[model samples]
Target: MKKYLLLSAFATLTLLSCNNEGTSVNNTVESMKTPAMENFDKAFKSLGDPQNRPTEEEKKRNTSELSDRRKALLVPASKELILSLGVTESELMRKTGGDMSQIIVWATQIYMKKSDEIRKNIKSEK
Candidate 1:
């Protein structure tokens, strides 16, 4: 009888532990989502959608707009790096107009690659 009781108790604890783990897994999944991540996902999805594709005529106009958007997002903080490097941000913008081609044409120009810490933070989100 004692052995039977012990076996039953062990089974009960095992079942309880497994139940707790399932709850934790559900919580983990729920916690994984954030507004920024949702926006990022949506942005990529829209980019991939066939309806969003641009024509050759739209390329120049769209390129300028995209460049402005990127500069607006990044140039504010990048000013210090730009100034310290002794490069004129305005002229750079005027010349490249936000195109990545500057890096290829002027191989010596400063290029900012994403840092490892940034990569880690982005990776951790998912």
Candidate 2:
């Protein structure tokens, strides 16, 4: 009876430890967002603001075009995100031709690539 009790206690401890390990890994991934990732997330999320969203008329007018006002809203955050990724102002201008949309797109691509690399590293570590 004592041996059976000891085995049950050991099994409980082993299961608890395994559960804690999974939670810790999830916590690590959640905490691993770099500043650049934060900035990129912020820049994209800005468009979800009511003031930033295009009205029906505006959308009908030109679905492909972002108005100057909308561009104004995105430019600062987008520039910050791009610069955080080690891109110089001159290099950004040369690469994006001073287009706010292009800057955002380029930054998003970089963000996705970096995110993929992080995920790959985490998977490999496990």
Candidate 3:
């Protein structure tokens, strides 16, 4: 009787866990169809136009917030990292931080990849 009770309890927990996971899987599938990429492309193109380049004030702020030397060091490394992640030049630039677009891009890729990996693992388990 004790063995039967333990098995039933284990089965109950497993079913409840799967039930909760069903909602998350459904939500992820729904979100995958959202028009987020369109919005991102629109915003990215706007940021790339020459006439829309950062203003003098913005440059000054960036320079002050982040020294020129650090910015120079990060920019190329950031660009390479973003490229590796398949992000476009315009998209990478749009995610700038003070003067550190490269670092920002790298960090963004890291986070996004991490989230994707986690989601993949969850799906695999399911």
What is each predicted model's overall lDDT from 0 to 1? 0.49, 0.80, 0.58
Q: For candidate 3, which ten residues in a row score worst on lDDT?
A: 33-42
- Residue range 13-74, candidate 3, lDDT tens digits: 99999999888886775455324332332434555557555667677676544344434544
Which sequence of candidate numbers ranks them by TM-score, best first?
2, 3, 1
Query: What local lDDT score does residue 45 receive in model 3, on the 0 to 100 scale?
Result: 52
Candidates 2 and 3: which is better by lDDT? Answer: 2
Candidates arranged by lDDT, highest first: 2, 3, 1
- Model 1 is weakest, by summed lDDT over 10 consecutive residues, at 107-116
Over 4 Å off, model 3 = 1-66, 108-126
Looking at model 2, the pairs that clash are: none
**Residues 28-124 of candidate 2: C-alpha lDDT, one tens digit per residue:** 7657877767766776688789977987777888768777677777677778777886889999999999987797678778778877887788999
Candidate 1, residues 1-126: lDDT per residue as tens digits? 999999999999999999997787556543553433333334434544565555456675755443433333334334334344456868657766755434223321332132333445555865
List runs of model 1 lying over 4 Å from the truth.
36-126
Better of 1 and 3 by TM-score: 3
